[model samples]
Target: RPAYIGERVVTPRTPADPTADSDKVVWSQTVSLLLGALCEKSWDTEKV
Candidate 1:
Protein backbone atom coordinates (compact mmCIF):
# COMPACT_ATOMS: atom_id res chain seq x y z
CA ARG A 1 0.00 0.00 0.00
CA PRO A 2 1.05 3.63 -0.57
CA ALA A 3 1.70 6.16 2.22
CA TYR A 4 -1.02 8.67 3.02
CA ILE A 5 -0.57 12.47 2.99
CA GLY A 6 -0.27 14.34 6.30
CA GLU A 7 -1.22 17.83 7.47
CA ARG A 8 0.65 20.68 5.83
CA VAL A 9 3.25 22.62 7.78
CA VAL A 10 3.82 26.39 7.50
CA THR A 11 7.23 28.00 7.17
CA PRO A 12 8.61 31.37 8.39
CA ARG A 13 5.50 31.55 10.60
CA THR A 14 2.73 34.18 10.46
CA PRO A 15 3.29 37.70 11.71
CA ALA A 16 1.37 38.74 14.80
CA ASP A 17 1.38 40.86 17.94
CA PRO A 18 2.24 38.54 20.83
CA THR A 19 1.37 41.22 23.38
CA ALA A 20 -2.15 41.84 22.15
CA ASP A 21 -4.88 39.99 24.05
CA SER A 22 -7.99 41.59 22.49
CA ASP A 23 -9.22 44.06 19.83
CA LYS A 24 -10.98 46.34 22.26
CA VAL A 25 -8.44 49.14 21.88
CA VAL A 26 -8.47 48.89 18.09
CA TRP A 27 -12.28 49.09 17.94
CA SER A 28 -12.33 51.96 20.39
CA GLN A 29 -9.99 54.02 18.21
CA THR A 30 -12.03 53.24 15.10
CA VAL A 31 -15.24 54.34 16.81
CA SER A 32 -13.63 57.54 18.00
CA LEU A 33 -12.49 58.43 14.46
CA LEU A 34 -15.97 57.66 13.07
CA LEU A 35 -17.65 59.90 15.66
CA GLY A 36 -15.22 62.71 14.95
CA ALA A 37 -15.82 62.55 11.21
CA LEU A 38 -19.59 62.44 11.66
CA CYS A 39 -19.49 65.58 13.84
CA GLU A 40 -16.98 67.35 11.56
CA LYS A 41 -14.63 67.81 14.51
CA SER A 42 -11.11 67.72 13.13
CA TRP A 43 -7.86 69.41 14.02
CA ASP A 44 -7.95 71.72 10.97
CA THR A 45 -11.38 73.20 11.66
CA GLU A 46 -11.51 77.00 11.35
CA LYS A 47 -15.11 77.46 12.58
CA VAL A 48 -14.18 77.32 16.21
Candidate 2:
Protein backbone atom coordinates (compact mmCIF):
# COMPACT_ATOMS: atom_id res chain seq x y z
CA ARG A 1 0.00 0.00 0.00
CA PRO A 2 2.92 2.34 0.56
CA ALA A 3 4.31 4.38 -2.36
CA TYR A 4 7.63 2.52 -2.26
CA ILE A 5 5.92 -0.86 -2.16
CA GLY A 6 6.20 -1.18 -5.93
CA GLU A 7 9.00 -0.01 -8.24
CA ARG A 8 8.82 3.58 -6.95
CA VAL A 9 11.96 4.92 -5.30
CA VAL A 10 11.90 7.25 -2.32
CA THR A 11 14.43 10.06 -2.02
CA PRO A 12 14.94 12.68 0.65
CA ARG A 13 14.48 16.36 -0.18
CA THR A 14 17.83 17.22 1.43
CA PRO A 15 21.01 15.25 1.82
CA ALA A 16 21.21 13.42 5.14
CA ASP A 17 23.77 14.54 7.72
CA PRO A 18 25.15 11.51 9.59
CA THR A 19 25.94 13.53 12.69
CA ALA A 20 22.56 15.27 12.74
CA ASP A 21 20.87 12.51 14.76
CA SER A 22 23.89 11.98 16.99
CA ASP A 23 23.78 15.65 18.01
CA LYS A 24 20.46 15.00 19.76
CA VAL A 25 21.62 11.90 21.59
CA VAL A 26 22.32 12.12 25.32
CA TRP A 27 25.47 9.99 25.59
CA SER A 28 25.66 8.40 29.01
CA GLN A 29 27.39 5.20 29.84
CA THR A 30 25.36 4.91 33.02
CA VAL A 31 22.08 4.93 31.16
CA SER A 32 23.49 2.54 28.54
CA LEU A 33 24.54 0.09 31.23
CA LEU A 34 21.21 0.35 32.99
CA LEU A 35 19.29 -0.23 29.80
CA GLY A 36 21.57 -3.09 28.82
CA ALA A 37 20.91 -4.81 32.13
CA LEU A 38 17.18 -4.15 31.94
CA CYS A 39 17.01 -5.46 28.38
CA GLU A 40 18.85 -8.59 29.40
CA LYS A 41 16.31 -9.29 32.13
CA SER A 42 13.34 -8.45 29.85
CA TRP A 43 14.82 -10.39 26.88
CA ASP A 44 14.53 -7.34 24.59
CA THR A 45 17.98 -7.30 23.05
CA GLU A 46 16.85 -5.41 19.96
CA LYS A 47 16.36 -2.21 21.96
CA VAL A 48 19.95 -2.25 23.23
Candidate 3:
Protein backbone atom coordinates (compact mmCIF):
# COMPACT_ATOMS: atom_id res chain seq x y z
CA ARG A 1 0.00 0.00 0.00
CA PRO A 2 1.15 3.53 -0.77
CA ALA A 3 1.03 6.35 1.80
CA TYR A 4 -1.33 9.17 0.86
CA ILE A 5 -0.45 11.65 3.65
CA GLY A 6 2.94 13.11 4.57
CA GLU A 7 4.40 13.65 8.03
CA ARG A 8 5.36 17.10 9.30
CA VAL A 9 9.02 17.84 10.11
CA VAL A 10 10.13 20.28 12.81
CA THR A 11 13.39 22.21 12.72
CA PRO A 12 15.93 21.89 15.53
CA ARG A 13 16.92 25.52 15.31
CA THR A 14 14.67 27.80 17.36
CA PRO A 15 13.44 31.21 16.25
CA ALA A 16 15.05 34.40 17.45
CA ASP A 17 13.54 36.40 20.29
CA PRO A 18 11.45 39.43 19.33
CA THR A 19 12.97 41.43 22.19
CA ALA A 20 16.63 40.98 21.19
CA ASP A 21 19.42 43.18 22.56
CA SER A 22 20.25 46.53 20.92
CA ASP A 23 23.82 45.40 20.17
CA LYS A 24 22.54 42.31 18.40
CA VAL A 25 20.28 44.42 16.21
CA VAL A 26 23.13 46.80 15.31
CA TRP A 27 25.49 43.95 14.40
CA SER A 28 22.84 42.31 12.24
CA GLN A 29 22.27 45.53 10.30
CA THR A 30 26.01 46.00 9.80
CA VAL A 31 26.44 42.48 8.43
CA SER A 32 23.41 42.89 6.16
CA LEU A 33 24.89 46.08 4.67
CA LEU A 34 28.21 44.33 3.96
CA LEU A 35 26.45 41.43 2.24
CA GLY A 36 24.36 43.84 0.15
CA ALA A 37 27.48 45.68 -1.01
CA LEU A 38 29.15 42.40 -2.03
CA CYS A 39 26.07 41.29 -3.97
CA GLU A 40 25.90 44.64 -5.79
CA LYS A 41 29.56 44.39 -6.81
CA SER A 42 29.05 40.88 -8.19
CA TRP A 43 25.94 41.97 -10.11
CA ASP A 44 27.77 44.95 -11.64
CA THR A 45 30.60 42.72 -12.88
CA GLU A 46 28.06 40.38 -14.50
CA LYS A 47 26.43 43.31 -16.36
CA VAL A 48 29.75 44.47 -17.87
Encode model 2's per-residue lDDT on 1-47: one tens digit a residue: 55541122123233375353333233344566788998797886565
- For candidate 1, the TM-score is 0.39
TM-score of each: 0.39, 0.33, 0.57
With a 3 Å backbone cut-off (N, CA, C), the pairs that clash in candidate 2 are: none
Per-residue lDDT of model 3, residues 1-48, tens digit only? 653212111221233643444445566678779999999999999999
Return the TM-score for candidate 2, rounded to 2 decimals. 0.33
lDDT tens readout by residue for model 1, 1-48? 653221111111333642342344455567768988867866557576
lDDT of 2: 0.48
Q: What's the CA RMSD for each of the models?
A: 15.2, 10.0, 10.6
lDDT of candidates 1 onward, in order: 0.47, 0.48, 0.57
Task: Give every collision pair in model 1.
Answer: none
Model 2 alpha-carbon miss at residue 10, Å = 32
Rank order (by lDDT, best first): 3, 2, 1
Q: Report lDDT (Cα) of residue 45, candidate 3.
A: 100
The runs of at least 3 residues in candidate 2 whose Cα sits more than 4 Å from the true structure, single-residue gaps closed, are: 1-27, 44-48
Steric clash pairs (candidate 3): none
